[model samples]
Target: MTIRLAILASGRGSNLQAILDAIAAGTLDARVVGVFSDRPDAQALQRVPEALRWSRTPKSFANRAAFDAALADAVAASAPDWVVCVGYMRILGAAFVQRFHGRVLNIHPSLLPKYKGLHTHQRALEAGDAWHGASVHFVVPELDAGAVIAQARIAVEPTDDADALAARVLTVEHPLLLHVLGLATAGRLAESAGHALVDGQRLYTPLPLPLNPT
Candidate 1:
């Protein structure tokens, strides 16, 4: 069965591009039915056909809840089997998370439980952490505090700044999201009893990021 995928992004759709590339390369058996964003000028919108692209300004809504409600409606219209958030800046409300539950996934720039929110690279540098990476996880209501499925680790260089670190992490993020999504499309990855499951087995720890050459 072909997996119907929907994407929500707020900036340049690097991850979105990765998924598209994977689908085109016949590495992922899925179709991106819809691409939605809060910003009309988000570069991610250009990755898909105009008909599949959707944009709405959050300021037009009275509150975050209202915006998310409308966004949920837009996503539901596509009847996506899974919703992936890549560079999506907004935090989803409880109602939206509950509506999709385990089906919604997100990729974060830092190893989760370390930096849950933005400025991940700067935070890691400030903390003087030795390693930094990205995480692919199930999206829950509490920020990035969801069950992680996989992570890609990269060593922090002494000369690395936020942008430099981000660029390195992004290299792994592309392959990581593609790898996890492939598992999801094949029904090999799922959430069970608040824990992530792979091939019907519980995942106590996130799987390591697959090695991809720069």
Candidate 2:
């Protein structure tokens, strides 16, 4: 059975586009039932067909929980088997996370457990780290502190700025996101004994890619 999916986002959605492309190409067995955005002008919303009931309104809700409740309602209405958060900037409430539980997946633009918060590329470049990457993890209540599903790391280039590094990391992110989504859709991705398991094996931490000449 195909995994029914809802996507949430708050910005320009390169990750969202990657998922859509993967679905279109039959690499992932899923259906994007709904696309919801907290921002009215989020570019991700434009990718959906007009006939689909996509939403971009959140100002009407009174509070954060209320917003989450409404958001949850929107997602439930779609009846998705799982939800994927790609570039979704909102810190979802505990209630929301619990409601979805193992059904929610998130993509972060960092190696994770290291740069769990923000400014990842810039921070990596500034800190002079050897590797920079993106991660896919299950969404839990505590920040990015969730079981990691998969990660793809690229070596930090010698002459890299934030923009240059982000661009490079994105290349790995696109494929890695698709692979995770495909695994989830196939029910091959699961959390067992506090570890994220793909095909019954623990996911490796941050497989670093070799830096290329720019």
How well does candidate 1 score on lDDT at residue 23?
A: 92
Q: Candidate 2, residue 188: CA error in Å?
A: 0.7
Clash number for model 2? 0
List clashing residue pairs in candidate 1. none
Lowest lDDT 10-residue stretch of candidate 2: 205-214
Q: Put down candidate 2 lDDT per residue, 1-214, tens digits, no spaces.
A: 7888898988888888887888888888888888888887888888888554455456787778898998898898889888888888888899998888778888898888888887889989878899888888888888898888778888887989999998988898888888777777777888665578777787666333344333
Off by over 4 Å in 2: 56-59, 200-214
- The C-alpha TM-scores of every prediction are 0.97, 0.91
User: lDDT of model 1 at residue 143?
Assistant: 92
